[model samples]
Every structure is written in C-alpha cells, then in structure tokens.
Target: MDYIKLLFALLLFLVGCAGISPKPLSIDQRLAAIPRKDAPLEHKLIIRWNEQAVPYLEAGSDADLAFGLGLVHAHLRGGQLALLKRISQGRISEMAGPFTTKVDHALRILDLGRAAPQIEAALPDETRRWLERFVEGMNYYQANTPNTPPEFSLLGISFEPWTVRDVITLSRLVGADVTWFAYFSLLSERRKGQTDEASWRRLIATTQAGAPNFRAAENDSQLLHDLLRASGRSGSNSLALAPGRSQSGGALLANDPHLGVQLPNFWILAGVKSPSYHAVGMMIPGVPIFGIGRNPGVSWGGTNMRAAASDIINISDLDPAGFSKRSELIRRRLWPDAKREVRFSSWGPIISDAELLRGGDGETLALRWEGHDPSDEISAFLGAARAKNASEFIAAFKSYAVSSQNILFADSSGVIGQIMAARVPLRSTSGRASFIRTLDEAKQDWSTHLATPQLPMQLNPQKGFLASANNRPAQTNLFPSSLFSDDERVKRLEELVLSRPLWRVEDLVQIQTDVVSRKAPALRDDLLSFMPDEATKRHPTFVTQLKSWDGSYAASSRGALLFELLLSEVAHKVYADKKGRVSNAASQWSYLTAYLKTDLSALEPHLCKEILQDALDKAAKRADRFKNWGEMHRLPTQHLLARLPILGGRFTLADHPASGSRETVMKTYHGLERGLHQTSYGSQARHLSDLSDPDLNYFTLFGGQDGYLGSQNFADQVPLWENQQYVRLPLREDVVKAEFKRVLVLPN
Candidate 1:
C-alpha cells in the first residue's frame, strides 16, 4: 500500500510538470494537418518554401497573391497573429486573464484602432479587394487547419476571423509614436521631483545637442510604448549609397531595424509576385505590405524619424462635465468580466486615467495623437512598394500620418534619396521644448499640419550617401521635439561611408556589424584625464587596460567592460541630486557623457579629482566580477512567456554573448546594472540590396522565419544574423524556382 501511494504521487508530479511545459506539435505534424494539394481561392496560387522556411508566393492575380500571403502567414505565425490582434484591439485580458487588466485598460485609453474604420472606408478599391481576399484566406486557414499552435489552447484564445480593421489597427500599434518613450522617461523623472525649470532647461539642451543631421549631411513601465516595444516597435538604422559611391556602380541600400530581443522575431521573410506587387523582403506579420523590400526598380529601407506627432495636454483647469465617458468590459480567462470607464476630452483621450500617467499628481491630462485622425498607411506602403522611381516613392507617402520615418531609397536609375514621411503637426509657437502643453495652447498649437513636400527631404546629396539612425534632420525647426538619439551611430555611419572612395555590398555588411564606438573612446579619454594620480596608482591594472583599450565592444573585450562600469559609476556621481538620487535624464549615455565633459571642466579642481577617484574605485570593484564584456553584456532572446515560473527556461530561445553598446552602430542597448546585464533592444532584422543584379538582395532576421515553438526553423536564422551572413532572396523567377524546393499548390 505504501509503495502504491508513493508511485501515485510521482505520477501526479510528472503529469503536472508536463502540463506546465506542454510540447508543441512538430513542423511536419502541423504542416501535414493542412490541406496541401488544393485550397479555396479565386485563382491558382503556388507557394514554395526555401530550406530556411521562407515562402515565395506566386499567383495569377494581385488578389490571389494577397490571399496566398495571408495563408502562408497564418500557417507559420497563427498564434502570434492572434495575440497581436488581441493586443491591438485591447482584448488581451480576455485571453491572458487578470494580470493583463492594466494592459487592456491602457490600450483602451490609447484606442489604437480609433481610426481603423475610417481608414478602411477610404482605402482604394484595388487595395480593398486585396485586403478582403487576404482576410478570406486567413479565415479559411483558421476554419480548416487542425492541430494549430499550442499557445492557442494554452492561452484559451478563440480562433476569430481576421478583418481589414485588424490590419489597420496593427499598423497603428506598430506606428505608436516613439516620442512616448521620451515622454514616459521624462515624466518618471518629473515624478521623482526633478521638475524645476532649470532642470528641464538643462535636460532639453543636452537632448538637443545629441541630434544629428542626414542632410548635413545628419519606458520602462507597462505603458503603451512599453507594450509597443514588447509588440516589436523600436528604432532602426538605414543607409543608401548612390552609384557614384558604390563599387558595383549601382545604388545599394542597407537596413537593420532595432526591436526588443525576443524569440519569433517581429518580422517575417517572404517574396510575393502578382500584377500590382512584385517585391521580396520583410513584412510585419499581420500587415500585408512589405515595409522594407526591393522591387524591380528600387530598393528601400527606413528609420524612425522620432517625430513629435502627439502632445500631452494638461486639462486640469477644464470642467469635468465636458469630458465624455464610456464603459468597456474587460473579460478575463478565469474571472468575471469587469467594466471599466474610459474618459475622453475634446482634445483626445484622457490618458491620465491609465496607470501610466498616474504620476500626473491630481492633474488631468489628455493625449492628442495624430494616430487618432483618419489616415491610410496601408495605401502609403502599397504605393511605395509599387513605386518605380524616387519621385513616385516620395509622392507615395504624401499622406502618411504617424510613426514618422526617414524613408531612404536607392533606385535602378542610380538615384538615392530620403524623404521625411509623416504628417507632422505644426506647433503655433516655434521652439517649444516642453512635451506637455496647456489646454488653451494645445487647442491652438496643433491646428496646422505638414505633409511630405512640406517636410524636410533630400535627393542625391553632395556626399553621395544618405543615412538615418533616429537622428534629427538638418532642419531642426521642422520638428517640434528634440528628443532624438545621440549622433553616435549616424556619425559612425558617415565615417565608414567616407573612409573609402567607393563601397561594395560586402563593405556595407561589414558596416552593419561594426561594433566600434566613437563616443566610448572620447568619454574614456575624458575620464582618464580627470582621474586622480593616486587612484591610477592604486588600480594599476585597470588604468593600464583603459589606456591600451580601443573602443571595440567585441565579445572578448575586457577593456570595454571596464569602461562601461566606470562610466556608470561616474554618471551616478555626477548626476546625483541633493538627496543622492540620480536624475533619469542622465540615463541616456550621450547626455551623461556630454554633461560630464562640460561639468568636469567647470568644477573646482579638487572636487573634480575627488569625484573621479571615487568613481574609479567603485568601477574597479565591479570590474573584478566579470572576465570580459560578453560575460556581462548578454543578448536576451527569451519570449515573454519566459516569465512563466519553472518552465520559463524552456521558452528561452537563446541567451548568449553579444557585442555593441547603447550608442554603437551595432546597437545592443544595456543599462547601468552593476554586474551582469542583458540587452533588451537592438538590431532584429538586416537587409541589403544591390541594384546591380536581380539576385543580389540579401536578408536575415534575428530570430527566425517560423513562429511555431517546436519547429526546427524557429531560431534557424539566428546564426546567420550573428555571423553577419544572409539568405539571398532573388527577384528573378528562375533563381527563385531553382532555390526553393518545398512546394504547395492552391487551386481555384
């Protein structure tokens, strides 16, 4: 009897463990479940898959191609697609349970889908037909396919049909103003009592100094932007080389978009051929357009313009009766549905009603974002994908409304250009540095808007190369906010571009992976100069390493680790307030370094020396804990599900040594954690296209092509990304047919 009881206990334990980490179906198992020989379609469509699981869809008509793409996307990333739709619609709580209530509340307040219905109504007839077919394909897959992704059952997600509104909503989600990140960071600091006028002025000045110009030649909370980052929205780096600067004598384009490090990357690799669209490149899973890709006439990429498309307006003085209120029912998986009230003002939504803005201290604030207005990003991207020249491409984005971008292009004509693509709100008062506006000011300031031709643009600059890395353009007056990234990445790109007279596709690849930091060396030199003699004598080995170190943040770099630790210590000491709390404004490395350079020089001689010595001592103590930079700076390739207790480790795709710093051209952003730190944001996908040959396009995703958990292709492309290698996706039909062997046929 005792033996039987013990056996029963062990059996129950094993079953519970299995339930925690439920195994997903194999790729073969999932694919076998789907009908391969035929499908419900308007025309015959052929789908071919490469060894890496990248799909190439060929169809008789544009609508059919759209349907085929929807089928392929659903087959590979059905779970991700479902989750994203829920997120965009503020319905995640219905699937994930009570923990996501706050998230749903925030999303409801932001109302990402506010303009979706209007945008859909205004869509061109052709685009609408394409979108409807895509929706049909997705619904067909969901209805017929069996053995779907395991996450669906685990999360209790219903297999809902896809809609055009869902696509528009997802676009808005991706284009959530990046400026909100700056706003949240600044607001958090203000909540910490750093709200004095002098502090605000100093912070604004330091931020402005970091902006770089392309023409010249240039959050932490579970806030909306935080959720956006988790849903894959972040910065990027893009460069275009005119024929004169290219070794191939053909224009070349290189792009690497940055996003939070996670499994099942935000992008999918695919090629589509149809009457209206013939392009090969990356596409956001739910969105139908190819965001970064190359067509027969041009290759293109983009970086976020960091446009001030929204403003936080203080409505504290406004009458409460004027506010509009609506009740939203938030359903949780295992709990009773809760009704929450969402308030809105004439300006926009009362964003302060969300926990994200609870720090507003009794003040009521509404967020007036350009995304709330009716606009068609779908038409803009579709137009861009079909554009045959620089002028057409520029005109395509004339009505682009939000998530502004520096759209860079390299055309078949060897013409390279950049256009600021966004409908920016023109402030009534020029040079308004504060992100927060008074209610009266908000009503008047944002009355006018600027579109494509009115925004700053450049065509074939004298330098023969154009690049954007979230830098301020040459015309600062055109943008309302100066919260741009420091010029480290852009400056490095310019250096590499001008390093030689001409460049090849291979050279651009090298530039993309370059980890050298110009700011690091400059900051190191400044620190060394201020170091006390006694401190250097005490830590001879540390001083020697710093002196001999170049600014390369390679995996094996010991000097890089030491420099980072020292910088963190120095920043803390320099920016600490009277209460010993360091300002969040200095959290930006560029601002910290700039502030230190100026402050160190102006400080009393003895005080500067003392601070330097103290910082060195602290850094040396921490440096003793790590063997090299890679040991401390790691890339966290874990899915959000990794937060699940005991089985979390199973969800982690990879946590390995990584190179690059916050400001390096190859960005892997880390903070001032004392010992080991994991990088949360960095390059997630890379694309390079040489217009010389139809087969010269190369691409790689930081994660993989397939989003299925147990699929062998899930993280297959990670090695290629890490090694700076690429998969050649050719536009030539013969080459594509020869390369992709696995096939599926869909018949009308």
Candidate 2:
C-alpha cells in the first residue's frame, strides 16, 4: 500500500515537473553571475573561496567586512535566508500556500519578531551602522545578482530588500528557546485527556529522571516547538580544556551543535580579517556573526542552557477589556488571503487563541517570554567577536536576553572558563515550579531580571576543563534552568576527558566522534536480568548476541540492532493503553529509559515479566529481517522538498549508514519504529581550535556550504564529516592565500 501511494505521488510530481522551467544555476555559474568587481563597497575587499566553497573574507575596515559577508550570505543562501525571514515574520503561508496557514497562524500568535523593532531602535551607534551596512550589502546582492535558487521559482517567492529589523528578527528566530520541545511533549499528553494525577506524576518523574533538571508544571504551546524545529536550532555539545590539561600548553575548544539533519546545512564556514574583527568559524546563514569560532586570543563554543526563559500564564480570570487584539491578513500563494486574530495580555501574547491550541474549555493562555523584550544579542555577539581576553569576552554578553546558553571559552593566555550568558528572570519561586501560572501568581513571581554577572560562572575550576552537552551546569544561588538534556553525553565526555592527563587536538577529535552509548549497556543488562528463562531459550542466538554486545552503536554491529528492537518492543508492551495502543508520550526514549530504570518489582513485577517475555518473543521473530544496525539506521541528508516523490530523489543529497544513538556522545536521534529509520536530528556542524596556534583551527559541516540545488559544493563535506575529518581554516594571511586560489575582489 505504501509503495502504491509512493508511485501515485511520483506520477503527480512528474506531471508537475513537466511544467517547471529555468533550472537553478550551478555553483560556478552562480559565482560568475555575482558582481565580482563592481560590488558596492567602501574599501577593497577580497572573498577567497576554497575547494569546498568556504569563503575567507579580508577587508580594511569592519564595515566593508560586514558588507562582504552580507553579499556572500545572500549569494550562497538566498533561498534559505528568504525562507527564514518569512518564517520569522509569520509569512510562510505567503509562499507555501494554504498548507502553512496553521503554521502562520501559530507564528502570528507567538510573535517571534515582536522585539525586533525595539531592539533595532536601541542598538549602539556603531552596531546600528554595522547592521545598516550589512543590510545594504544583502539588498545589493539581491538586486544585482542574476541567479535565483530554484526554490524561489518553485515556491513562487518574490525576494524583498533586507532591513535591520529583519536581521534582528531572524536573530530572535534562531535563538528561540529550545526547552519548548520538552514542554510540548509533556503538555500534548495532557491535552489528550491523560490528566490523571498518577499518570501526570509518572510522566513528569520519568522525564525528570532521564534529563535530571527543573521541569515546568504547566505545559508549553506547540507554536514555539514548531518554530524552533523549522529554524534548525537545537542542542549542542561544547568543551573547553585549560592549558594545564592540553598537550599544546594552550587552551583547546571543541563544539558540535546538534540540529535537524538536512541540506544547505545549518552553518556556513567563513573567516574574517578586518581592523576590528578577526576570526574564523561557523556562521548562521542569515545572521552576520560567528556563532562558534576562534580569534587570535580566544576560542569559544556554547550549548543551549535550556533556561526557563518563558512561562505560560492562565489569564482566564483576567478582564477582557485589558487584553489587546489585532488582526493580520495572511497571504497565500495560490489561495485567497486569510485573516488571523492575535490577542495580547499584559504578560505576553495570548497563545491559546491560535488555531493549533484552542482548548474547548475557553481557557486563556498567554506566553510570557524574555524574548518578547528588546535585547541586544547583535551587540553581544559583535562585542564577543572582538574581545581580546576572557574578561572582555565575559563582559560582552552582559545584555544578552534569550535562549540562555552555557558558553565555554579558552584563551591563548592559558585561561579556560564557563559563563552562563543570559539575562535570567528573578522569580519569586526560585526552584522548579509549574510552567503555567495564574495571572496573579505570574505578576508576583516575575518581577526583576539578573544579568550575566549575577548568573553562574566558573573562572578556572579545579577540574581543568568545562563541558556541557545541554546538561545541567553547576548549581548556584539561582538555578539557571528548569530543564536540560540527558546526562549520558556529558558523562561520556567527562570519562574521555579524564582518561588522559593531557590531550591533543587529534585526541579530542576522537571524543567528538565517539559513538559509545552510556545508557544502552545499563538498559541492556537490566533487560537481560529480567528475561524469562523460557523466552531466553526460545531466542538463544539473540540472547547470546545481546550479551556479547559492548554498548557501542557502531554501524556494522548486529548486537546494536537486536538490542534496539527489543527495547522498542519492551516500551510498546509496557506503555500500552487499555485498548493496547502504545501512548507515544510514555513510549518516548526519554521516558522509557527512565521508566525501565526503576524497580520493576515495586510496580507490578509479574506484569513486567509478562511484557518482557512478550517483547522478547516479538523481537526474536522480527530479528531476521536485517543483517546489522547500519542497514536499519540511516542518516538522511534530504531537504523538505524531497517529499515531492519523483524529483524528490534529486533533492536528496545522501542516505547512508550512520553510527550513534540518541544517547551517545555522537548523537544521531531516531525513534523505535520497528523497521528501517532515518536520523532526524544530530551533529550538524563541528568546530575545534587549539589556541596555541592561530593556524591550528579546523571545521566541518554535515552538509555543504552552498544552498543551490545540484551544486557540486552541496553536501561536499558529508564524507569528510562522516570520516571525522576537518578542513583547515587558518588565520594567517600566508596560509589563507596559499590554500584559497579562487578569489573574487570587490573594489571600492
């Protein structure tokens, strides 16, 4: 049946493709089409491209460098940037038609860009000028460039001029709070009528056990979850080694940001050399700042702190006269423009008004997030980029507001430190509390804010290294966040870091790609201990293979495949409802792993035994279909457009065997579907820098640098990334000139 549906979809795609024209230009042709010599610039700037299309920009002033970066971003990622702007502004329905109307409605309710104009107005003089120049460069490229990505034509999008407000809004979109995913997971279960006290307690306990941090009592709206997922901004792993712990006798920094696996990758590799700014690292497509990279004195990387930056308020008791309301006309590509009504309370936007979250009970819920306030993340990152030392770096983000992070940095002066870079709210209830609060409770709790200085910071801890994999940081007077990622990845990193007295860059690379699962072995042993003797006899070969397994999610391991299948079956049996349907909420790996860790004897041991026996029997019957884990576990590097059946195959860059599981240090996230599954989220880009030498920096992306379809540079780095290799991005001018031969000089 699935095959037949696929065939029908393919037929439709073929019929549609017959009418499409003016195919996207190749990378070389696109480069040729760009205004190389006559680009609008205040000073001579050179953009040198390497074999993989990584650009090294050199300019006399920071303004020109910003302009050149804008041009480079627009030329390579115009489609992605355009899509991001639309997403940020709640205008995706304008291009994708009615299919995205609900998405647009949700975005409108959340108003992710509400703070952009205020942020733009308050920017420092130099920062405002910097953004103005950057916008100018982006608009110039859009107006002058002859090539347009195929997506623009296919989606019927008209590229518009860039603005500072647009830049700030996109920044807000990229930094949207990631904790909302966990929140939605918990709340969606409640919305489904699983609101019994015992069930709710079990759900919260299981979630907390796996992640081990503060959790919200109230559930989150789904709009923020969908937005963050679409934006491809998720968790990350970052570690900084002190000079004493490094073989090079200088601080070392390594980072790998986990994001949704797709094409045109989340990051673009770039190096900048100007009077005020000098650095090389990963830059987000639309934003003009080095998110993770190294300068002459310091190298820095960060993980999402998962801070409780927002709260859902129940304002049903509030007076309707106090609520502000507005309506927006949502434009659809081929369909008629639809009208959406957005409501706002004193706390924030009324999220319950959106079509996606309309509770029949007529309860009013508003989202009060720090992101709604005007904050200068642009100036923060800009300041950090040019900081000369650790103190300066720490001071740079004093005004940073949303998407709290644990920033780890290493400096050439033998300094290593971690700083909680966020403007945290000082709540009356300090510890973990329910996310959804009554209007009065919210008014009393959320009164003031804490700057970076008041937040947690470790300036050279005794451990000689700092690491964060979206895990809980050291607790201080005020806890940074109520929720965080599972501790398995951070534990694995600590174990590896402690295994060696002093580490080299090569040694750290091994840690970055480590595929061993810390949670798998314990879970596997628990299952084996509970297996019925008769069931073990029935699946002797499977039991033997499982026992011999070492808990490594190596692609070729048959044991890994068998273990995962058994685990999946066990979760299904244990979490089944009265009708025998497994509740997805309880069956999630995060909850299942934690639930299994508890004493089965304390919670119906006989039932657990029967479930285990049945699970083993079921898994054994299905174990013969595949040879190894790799056959079932795949890394899909395909764009969203790949859903279009026939031509979809062309959009798919690569579908190859992948290593690592959701809990492994090298995270490749998948669900228990009982058959072949592709990784949905994992390491998108990697950056490592040895501060001892400016030339000892390396970076790689899961996909390629170019966003154009069918470009040679698209997905060019996938093999290098799979093999754990990196491209050398040197800071020295001599090395840069020697390595990058293709140069596009923009004259004044």
Candidate 3:
C-alpha cells in the first residue's frame, strides 16, 4: 500500500511539471480569429498599387505627391518607421524595454533630436512645405487605419504623428552610419606606440584602403561600440558608359550599393508623379524623394563617397562655460529609476570614460560630428528628382551639405558624367594628419568647406567609361582626408570595362554580378608551387581541385571554398600582431594578396610551408563536410525578430546558397571576426538603367518592400534577387496604372 502511494505521488509531480496545455482552436475557429480592419481611401489624392503592392501616386502638386508617399509608407512600414523615430529620439526603451537602453543612451549623446528643430526652421520654404504635407499624410494614415502591424500590438505601443523633425532625424541617422569618425578613433588607438614615424606613415598609406573595421571588440561597452557598429562595413559598385561605347548608341549606367543585408530592406520601391515631374526608385521610407532613380530622360545612382566628415577631439581641460549641461532620463519599460546626466561641450558631446578612455591629464574626449550641424541634403535630392538633363543634375549636386556620395549620371542626350558630391571639409594646412589629438587643434576645424567647383567632377570623360567602387576618385587629386576602398575592385572593374568594346545594358549587369577573382589565379599558382611531394601524395584530391579551379566563386566550385579557407588560414598565420588586439589583415585582400606574392623571406619565420601544410589538411577536412561550395557558402538574412525562438524562423528570409567571396565582383564580404564564408555584408540593391529605353530600367532589392507579416509583398523579392533576376521599374504612367491591382484616392 505504501509503494502504491509513492507511485501516485510521483505521477502527480510529473503532471505538475508538465504545466497546463495551451488551448487549441479548430480550423473554423482559426479562420475566424483573424484581425479585421477598415481602411478606406480619402478623396484628395490617388494611389495605385501594383500587383506587388508598390504604390504609384499621382497628385496635382509635388506636395500632394509627398503626402501620398507618406501615407503609403506609414501603412506598409509603420512599425519600422515608428521604431526608427523612437531610436533617433532616444526613446526606444519606452517601447522595446531594457535591451535597447544602451542604444537609447548612445542616441541621446548623438542628439539628432536637439539639432532637428533648428534644421527644420532654416529649410527653404518649398522644402519645408513639402515636409509638412508629408507629415499630414502620415497622420491621416494613422487616424484612418484601424489596425497596425503585429509588432505594435505585441509591444503595446501606438503610432504617433511624425513631425518634419523625424524626417531630418532619419537623414542624421543615415549620416552617422556612413560617416568615418569612429573608424579614425580605432585606427588612432591601433597606431599607438609605433616609434618609427616613417614606417607609421607608410603603413597608413598602404593600409588606409580597406581598413576591415568591424563594429567593436567584444569587451567594449554599448556606447562607443554602437558608434563603431552604426554604419557597419560596406562597399558599393557604380559605373557609366558613354554613347560611343554603348552597343545601342545610348549611354548605360549601373549601380549596386552594398550594405548590411536585412529583411524589410532599408529601401522601398515607389513611383511618384505630379504635373511638375515624374520620379521612380528605391525611396527610404521617411524621405519624400527617391534617393537613387530617374526622372524622364535623366537617371542617376550613387555609392557612399567615403568622405571624412567627422572627427574625435581630445579635450584637455574643457571650460564648463563653453558648454551646456543636461540630464536625459532614460525611460525604461522594465527597469525603474534609471536616469543619468551627460555633458556637452562647444565641440560636441563628451564621450563617457566608461565608453572610451579619457586623456592622461584628467581630460575628457568629445566627438564633433558634421551631421549635427544644419545642412540641406533633402533639397538636393528633390531637385535631382526634377532634373531633366545632365547639366540640371549637376546643378542639383552643388547644394549637398551633409552626406557624401559618388553620383553617376546618364541622360537621353547621350551624355555620361560623374560627380563626387560631398561637404568636404577644408582641413587645416596640416589636415593630412590622420589624428587630431587635441581639442584646441580641432577647435577651428571644418571652418570652411570645398566649394561646389572644388569638388571632383567630370562630364563625358575621353575614356568613354567612368566607374567608382568606393575607390580613389583620382590617382593624384583624391579628397585630402578620404579613406578610399581597396583598389582591387576598381582595377578589376577597369579590366572588365576596357576588355569589352561595345557594351550593352545586359553586359553591364553581367559585370555587376561577375564572380571572377583576380587574386585567385596567382594564389592557386603559389599553392601549387609550395605543395611538397608528401603533401601532394597525401592531399591529391586537394591538389586536383585547386588545379581545376577557374577562380570564379561559382556555387558549385569546391575549389573556391577550399581556397578561401586556405587564404584565411594563411592570413591568420602571417599577420597575427601580438600588440594590436585585433588583426584586420585577413579581410584586407589587397594587402594579403600582395604579401603572398612577395619572397618567402618576407613571410613570418618558418610559417610559409608549415602554415600551408596545416591549412591543406584542415581544408581537406572542411571540404569533406560539404558536397560542394553551395552547401557551405550560405547567405543568412537575419531579421530583427530572429532573436525570438518561435518568431525567428518565421521572420528570417530563407537562407540561400550564395556565390562569390570577398575578392569577387559579385563581392559578398564577411568580417574575420565572424566565421569565414558567413555572408553578412553584400550588395543590398542592384540597378541597370538603359538610356536606350528609360521605361526598361531594371533593378532588385535583397528583400521586398512590405514590413508587415501578413503582406504578400514581404520577402517576395528574395527568390528573384537570389537568382540575379531584376524586375522592371516602368517609367510610363499608363504602364504603371495598368499593372496595378488596387487604387486608393485621398481627400484633398
């Protein structure tokens, strides 16, 4: 009887541990559980949605088109837009909880919100009115739409009226990401203790291109770390062909802005038309104009012009009178009584000691970011959207003040041009210095900027082709403080362009997705020469694979995978600096390729053969795990909700097998900090514009436009984008109206 009682007690404990089961619903009940909404169109404006739900807005005026853009943007990406505004305002913790408190703190220090009102007040009346109309449209969408994205309901947050300041804030956020202030900070710290000044200068000259700068070291706190990680590491490709070089007797332009891959892509496809003009391209959600696209006969696209627009100042004994003190109450949903005070000097916001080190003489450090200063980039893009020809487009480039970009222009008149548009700081006479270590030294910095004429620009170059892959604009006259990308991409681009005589738009697209690596063949030759008889006998399969490789990182090529692994291992063995906490040599292809081709005496002592043999054995093992390269080289499209176990799988775009290594023109690059072959960064958007037929302009995004889960358009582009397919971005209004499935009219 006692044994029976014990068994019964054990069963009860088991049942209790199991917990109550969640209630299950039948199919009928599940069908009925869907959320209902009543969203009707207003009468003032007309919106036509394509089969993919991309909106085409036709308004009586430009302001109305702005209103329509805001309305559609709010409906499709309300959650993302709201979150961006919240983050920029340093109010993310109010909705996202404690995890984002650090992000909030960093944003508060950056203080784009404080600078927004002043920026808005000083804007031209035309730009200001357009922004106002955009705000009204967003507000109207919020009032009329009965339902919001599931994320809002899950977080228990509601959308608020977006102000024009929010638009300015978005631009500031973009500027912070693309700016290189934190890059110089890390480079400065890394270059410390180098006694040989000449060697240091030479090292700067050699390694400045492709710094391989990551977000931050693992030990870093969230503030400086976030700043380092803001822009993340990215590269781009852009080119234009003159009429003489084109197969169709018209110019062609191509661009693919490489950015951190994400779902609900950083851009949205939109077509806006008013009586004044027509524009179409990938529009950042909050901004009114298409950042890279065409209007009528003119088409334009850009790459981040890696300009030196930010600086870190070491303040030795700052005067309190020259600054303002404020306390930012970091509101938290989870943590209570969390408040902190921070100070800002005349230079900029002071970096906290916890985030970065203070000077030795009881000094603080401040960051003077050019983005905080008021400038008008929005007006420039708006003007560009209305530009009809090459000269008009070049005129629009003159007013750009904040962000730097390499603009490529092609028009109906057979003209091709390039503009290095940026608010380039007129550095002091000694501005060639990479580090400005004293606050007094940087006090009068950026006092003057390069005038529009001073900016490097060319129209119809005699070469018949112009290209920029974030490379040095000119061999001699580069921007004084520019940190250009590695020259390999540009060199390879020139080879491909020069090799071809008569180019077509299709040929340009082929170049955009080209996977041939210039360094691979030479490296393969070196490995063959280094292989000993013993290695050749033991690793015959590896030797055979290496010999058979054509150097293209095609998905089926196992040799490409093996070579990438071998290269990474060799880099680790060769450039592992004991003093520098991080080694960036592995990701710097130009440096590594150059080093490998040099004499054996140049290599680390006793490492050349030893490292090669070890890498071969490891590669053999790694090779066995995968049937081919496609199985190993995967592109992981991480989503914000991917952190959640249940929702993660649902939100993430399908992990597709990606081709191309860091050295390829297809150019999917990953950091050495992460595991090799992990596709973290690559081209997020690709465009091929044909001047022969403007309506035939084709482009693709890594993902689709919609951010909402229920929307079919969400993640719709992934399959085609992965397959290197592009959809038409029709320029004609009649075609757009015919392709659309739904029409929405807004009340004026």
When 1 and 2 are scored with lDDT, the better candidate is 1
- The lDDT, on a scale of 0 to 1, for candidate 3 is 0.66
Best to worst by lDDT, what's the order? 1, 2, 3
What candidate 1 gets wrong by more than 4 Å, as runs, is: 1-30, 36-38, 191-197, 207-220, 223-225, 577-581, 602-604
lDDT of 3 at 472: 66
Clashes of 2: 4
Worst 10 residues of 3 by lDDT: 16-25
lDDT of each: 0.79, 0.78, 0.66
lDDT of 2 by residue, 418-516 (tens): 888877677665443454567776786678888677887888889998889887777663644545676788989999999989999867889999889
- Give the clashing residue pairs of candidate 3, or none: 42-745, 42-746, 42-747, 43-746, 43-747, 44-746, 44-747, 44-748, 45-746
Query: How well does candidate 3 score on lDDT at residue 33?
Result: 25
Q: Mind giving the per-residue lDDT tens digits that candidate 1 earns over 1-748?
A: 4464355434433434433354655555655655544576667788888888899999999888988888888888887888788888888777656656777887898899888888999888988987888887887788878656756655666588888888889889988887666665556555554644454556567554322111000021433444676553457899999999888989999999887667778889999888888899999888888889999998888988877788888889999899999999998766689888899888888877876554447878888899999887778888989988878888888668878888899999999999888888887654454658887778787888888779878989988999898888657576666567787889899999999998888778889998998778888999899998999999999999987889999988999999988988887787767876555455557666667788888889999999999999999999998889999999866665565434456678678898998878888887665679788677878999999887899999887888877777778888898888999999999999999887777762
Deviation of model 1 at 277, angstroms: 1.4
Q: For each predicted model, how many residue pairs clash, with residues at least 3 apart or on different chains?
A: 2, 4, 9
